[model samples]
Target: HFGIVRFPQKKNIVFQELNYQYSFSDWIQWSMKIDSDQKTKEEYDKKIILFPEKKQIRQVDEPWFDMLLHKATIIGGEGRLGRNNVIFTLSLAYYSSGYALETCEYNMIEFNERLHEPLSSAELSKIVRSAYSGNYEAASREFIVELCQEWVAPELKNKDLFIQRKGWWKFKKPREQRKYSHKKEWKEDLVAYLSEKSYISKPYLTLSKKDLASELGMPKRTLDKVLKELKEEHKVFYKVTRGRNGGMVIASVKALFGTIIQVRKEMQQAYVAAITEKFGLTGSFVLNTFKQLAAPYKQPEEVRLFTVDTG
Candidate 1:
């Protein structure tokens, strides 16, 4: 036999159950030893009348209870998801907070320690909430917006921000995740410097690696790397000369011609043809006309004649 009971508490009521089981032999013995007398039968009947029938209660599984347990595990911060794991990271934060679609604010101090740049508290919270609610498209959009602001903003460029640290942007990947190539920028600056000096007919500049690195505000190793790339591309020529003034001489091959010489041979031919056609003259006539036109423009050299007479 089983019975269900509800215990009342100050705040809520708790439901409990009690159960008793009897074997076949015990039931048979009890049945056979039943009272036959009228008084005993009346008492048995009264007892039976006093007790209520037991109702069979089926145990139902509550999925929500299991979900709550899972959520608690995540909220306890048992593990960390990598920055590259965007969806998983957001989901973890979401489930941990009791499946909250949004959080009030992001932990700025934590972010600053990790990413070196603290994102806006409100923006990060909204993005996390959006990702948690399975709005991946919206979450992605918000994430990209923040990433651009942090990574590509003009004011942020050249700043010694910590882009190498992992898990910098929470759900977004770090800048170091992809290899950065500054060869183009370096080459441009180097070329510009060469061009400036070459303008004064100085096609080459000699400087030590350290000095060049200092001028470019980069490490010597980085300068070497950029120079190597520039050399391979044939965009700039450099060589180390040996002497008291031994140093790396960077030459601008393209800048040697300070002005671009545009040959107009075809234009000259066209002009000759037009003059011949318009004047209805032969090639010889055009040639003679050009000679006569140029004669007036020619400056004659002064002639000094000395006469030595024999007496």
Candidate 2:
């Protein structure tokens, strides 16, 4: 139903004529600042969701949301799908709660001849509801409607008229009958994936670029970008294998003189502690020595990780 957008200013201009329940600015601002309303803030806290980008909690008189709202483009006069229907610039678009302002087929042309004759999103929703159960496709859907009735959550809007089984339950039944006791979950966590290598385990070490992307369910283009970042961070390396067109990804392991050491964030503290105890090093002396050993690999601000050199 929605896609992330780049270049908010450009997107605002592109969707200037569409109807939306919440503006893009509001969505982005909420992530940056909490609500000013006391009751609203209390309810938001109850949800247990944390916004990492949040810089400050809003004071009652703050204008944080308005600051973002004013940056967006808006259409004026008439010719809109319905009344009070604003558009999103860099966020998902949705209609207002129980908004019944229907643009007539005849009136749509009058509004925008550029659009040509077509059914509006509202009309399309009605058509889609016909295929699904009435319990699910209820009109004027308002789950989480109280949380800015205009900004009701998508998942909360779901409804079932009768009892039903979750899709996974059926899958589990067959596995249980077979006495299956093991399952491996596929999570798309990049950090967790990179940090969990065993002594002899280098899963992606031999995977070709294409196969790696398929396993990660990532696009080849995106995979290339991620690999580049990982390589720069000394986390992984992309080395071309002999007799192959596509290269493979290898964990950044430093081998010197008959000894090997893997440089990873997970190993950093342990490496530091060991050196501190063995050589009686402490404080800046430890950091300075680590830096000397890990030179040519500059500490990229607080992001850089270090390991004891095998020398």
Candidate 3:
């Protein structure tokens, strides 16, 4: 996404997840998530004759509620879970109608199987069939509310007003996970990474602003600032050669020749750096060391090698 520099303001380029409102099918698909996750839990079951006073621990917990809360609109996509009845049956039934596997398995098992308490097999079969044949929405909210009422216990049925609500999910504001970092921290991480990759004092190689900035999750201007700072120190150099095969490499003869040589051998061809300077082998010792390595290795015609002033 290109930033709006002058003429226009940069509107939010990333998708804001809060805009989404879940539908009945969305509720159903999420509800039907498989309960694979299990861990030991110790709860006091007063009715336990063997250990009424003691806590009992066993693998018994469902991770269904932890699933992603995205709305599913596709009739086919809604019904294609590996297996898990996540939200509630009314929604599950609506989606199951579209699922060939769910509908085709038994007369009315798709929706009925997901229920904690099953309804009448005969009555449910006929009703669900109509929904399967493209009448899912037609299966009114009243039917869903009634289904909830039927499944609940006789004592709890007194809360008829509460039963009016559909599905298992409660109305709570969603929370978005955010990672916090200070500018100082970001600069530190970038410096450390670049230093580690370039072998510090013997710096070599760097990437294009567009590519490296994006890879490092940083702004190009910030990268430029860091690199410019290093260049002013005269510890490194950003050199660009001429001709068709020419390109840029950030290096310095001020750095140890052995260190620079070792980096080329161990590190990647292109380094992730934010340092720059005016570059060349100026020091006699640093220059001769590189010349030694390049000796018996004549410059390739296709690729321009260093200029050695023998005089």
Candidate 4:
């Protein structure tokens, strides 16, 4: 008879359950661990099979299984996995008792599933602007890291520690060169960059700080600071319109426009690809694009952060 199996390790008093699909004998039977403790079991299992290679267990791909392993390694490891069963069980029970799922049809639930929501148009714009700012302290990395670290770290000590210990992403852009291109003019460059991305109706010939900086091998951080200084001096204007609060300063309009447009286009494309197959557009590309852009409306607070412009 087929039934769900709940395994309880001695020291790890918590119970780990899995739905087993039985086939003929043990040869074809398959089961997936639902808890994060699977990694612990796997390590132990791997060690057990060292003496007898023929007795090794079959490995299968499952999100839950991976999650379990991730948890075991991250959360617990008082020496070997099963060394302190009681502590493991207590920890598992304490953690699993609080488990809550938004949906039951679970297609491999992620740890941050509860926290993650789509970014709205305004929010996307803000993230882009912040990225342009190049100030790590003021960037959204703090909030993003906090949101993501909760599910993964058992005891995160500090933000810097998390950043250093955990994985972090970096932005890359090419160096700027000035001699070959048209002479740098703030107004002209800003207009050209925006027009290229269809942000503005017409392209002007002036060079923006961002664009010129790119052309002249200026560091992104240095460019952002210079743009801010220029904004204060009335040499550049930071413009913010409806919905998405993007910026175009007189000094760096060209580079800023390029960055914002590229980010929006990439985000839109990713959203489209993710949902297109599930909710078929009937091959209607226009309809699909509209649908993808319509998302990121779930959280207004989050959306507002992205929409706030320097202007």
Candidate 5:
């Protein structure tokens, strides 16, 4: 005969044979056997015990599971699932949801302590829905860092009601230092700083690397190393004049565009001269032909090519 065991508090149901000797602990083991891989099962077994003295559920190695159980206790009540049954219910929920371990760990940290005592069913459902739907693997590092900050160091003091016992706050202090080591982000910040300075001052003005390092709050050695790499990549240049203040200058986008326009103008003039010589046409005739060809794209103002008079 088949009998159904319903855990109303956990919203879980299990089917068992009435004729066989089946304890709730046996059901948990059986469920874990089917659902978890050997590695995960072994790890879970090492951390958690089915039944303990005074029925206190002890989670040893798995912080994620410990947090989950704590949140579950807050939501479902102390006696809803026994020490033996809670893991089984949560395990079933976890396996059925098909989230990776990394995803679960990160998302759990993000939504940590969001659910609390005197919980409403609607609020619980929303929290559960977010946990299930979250894609931590797809999330960017910046986004994860920001979320961690919000969890650990919220702006308003009143919002710090549910600070997690685990060291989430430990993350906030070292994040800026960690970002300095990241080459891509560091380069982008440097470029933005240079661009802002170039805009405020005249374009293509020489900037002191020492002053720039001081302004950016970075070491001169680090700035020099990054500048050397950027110079090799043609992203920046330095003017090696014999003076105390002479140093590197960031290339301006406006100056580059002006150079491009000047080159194009010179190329157009050469092409016109070549056509005049080939056709044995007069300079005026070739010039008129070029103007007719460009008539469709006539500019409102005359185009003046940029030039520096050395004389």
Candidate 6:
């Protein structure tokens, strides 16, 4: 709706109009920057949820909320979806005495925690009610509509009613359950399919279960069963999301120097932790390995078996 409002008359630009540079170096550099920005945003977003507040109180979720909102504000410095929606939701939830939003600070925290992620009206309702410790399930959606109407802006207040009126419940189901979970025999087929494609991110290493199942051509339930078998057999490591629901990644163990170590899996963790732990060894080890490998692979001189040089 926002995009439509802003660019109603403007046509979508095509690749030809994008004025893309043709140099490999420029393209690679640009791609890397985009990938880096995307990764940083994802990491920061996760951190916001995990530590919503900064100061920890025994039996109080205040500190976690503070941390989340703070991080959300920092990331949403550009005033994009992350910041505005987070602030709006927290403000609304807090005003409604949502248990999840213990106070204004807590509400702000949750808003930041859920930034940029789409939630169905039902899911939003569940989250709002869950904010409070006390159970308060109403007879109908009237309470939720009123809460939103009172809390959010005039534009956003009626979003719940809009969602319900438009039959948004149909889209609320977990993606994996709705799509995959229907068959059991497609495990190997799914793996083979995923293995064939070179993913922008690592395949089967750290993606969501839904994403992996989609790649595998199996139901999410079926994928779960297969993943369990694989993890038990030490065939692959599916990395689950932390805090909020995260995806799974396939961590294939590699035999290096008689040691069964997950090269990619371990390194990814080390890389993530290194950002927090400057003394961490993961980043250093990978860097050293790259340097060592590059030196040997470099060609000092070129030899021609058949030379046709005219002097």
Please give the CA lDDT of all the candidate structures: 0.43, 0.36, 0.39, 0.34, 0.43, 0.40
TM-score of each: 0.26, 0.23, 0.23, 0.17, 0.28, 0.22
lDDT of 4 by residue, 1-311 (tens): 34665566687566544675445655333333333367787888778632222332211121222333234322212111221221222222222333222221121122223223322344333333332232322212232233224434435434423223223434333324434322234434533444454332221233444555677455656556655665444333343222344333232323332333335544644433433343233335523233232221111123322232211
Clash pairs of candidate 1?
A: none
**lDDT: the better of candidates 2 and 6:** 6
Off by over 4 Å in 4: 1-99, 102-162, 166-284, 299-311
Model 5 stretches astray by more than 4 angstroms: 1-181, 199-201, 242-245, 252-255, 258-311
Name the candidate, 1 or 4, with the larger lDDT value. Answer: 1
The residue-by-residue lDDT of candidate 5 on 1-311, one tens digit each, is: 12575554434535555597778888888877766787787898899744333432222222334333454333332212222222222332443446554554444434334544333344333334433443221222232223223333334232232223432223443545665455555566676665665532233445577777888777778877777776555454344444765555554332332233335455645644543454344667544433332221121123332221100
Q: What is the per-residue lDDT of model 1 for residues 1-311, given as tens digits with 9 covering 90 to 100? A: 22364566755735434465677788767665663466687888788633344443211122222222122112111111212223223334434444434331233224322543333454345434544444232222223233223333424321222223222233534535745535566678877777777633344677887888887666678788888886666455577766787787675534532211111434444544543454344656544443332221121122211110000
Candidate 2 to truth, TM: 0.23
- Candidate 2 error regions (>4 Å): 1-188, 197-204, 252-311
Candidate 4 lDDT score at position 266: 42
lDDT of 2 at 4: 72
| Model 3 Cα lDDT, one tens digit per residue, 88-196 | 2333343443445353336235434544444456534433443344433322333333333333322333233222333343454332233544445555655555555
User: What are the clash counts of all predictions, listed in order?
Assistant: 0, 2, 11, 25, 0, 30
RMSD for each of the candidates: 34.2, 32.5, 34.4, 26.3, 26.8, 28.9
Residue 187 lDDT in model 4?
A: 33
lDDT of 2 by residue, 1-311 (tens): 13575666864665564565687787777755643566687987899854345242221112222221232222222222111121121011111112122322222223322322333555333322221222222212121222222222223322321123333332455533654322121222343454444232232245576776686565677666666665455444346565646455444322110012444456546655643454343646645534443432121124333332111
Query: Residue 13 error for model 1, in Å?
Result: 45
What lDDT would candidate 6 get against the real structure? 0.40
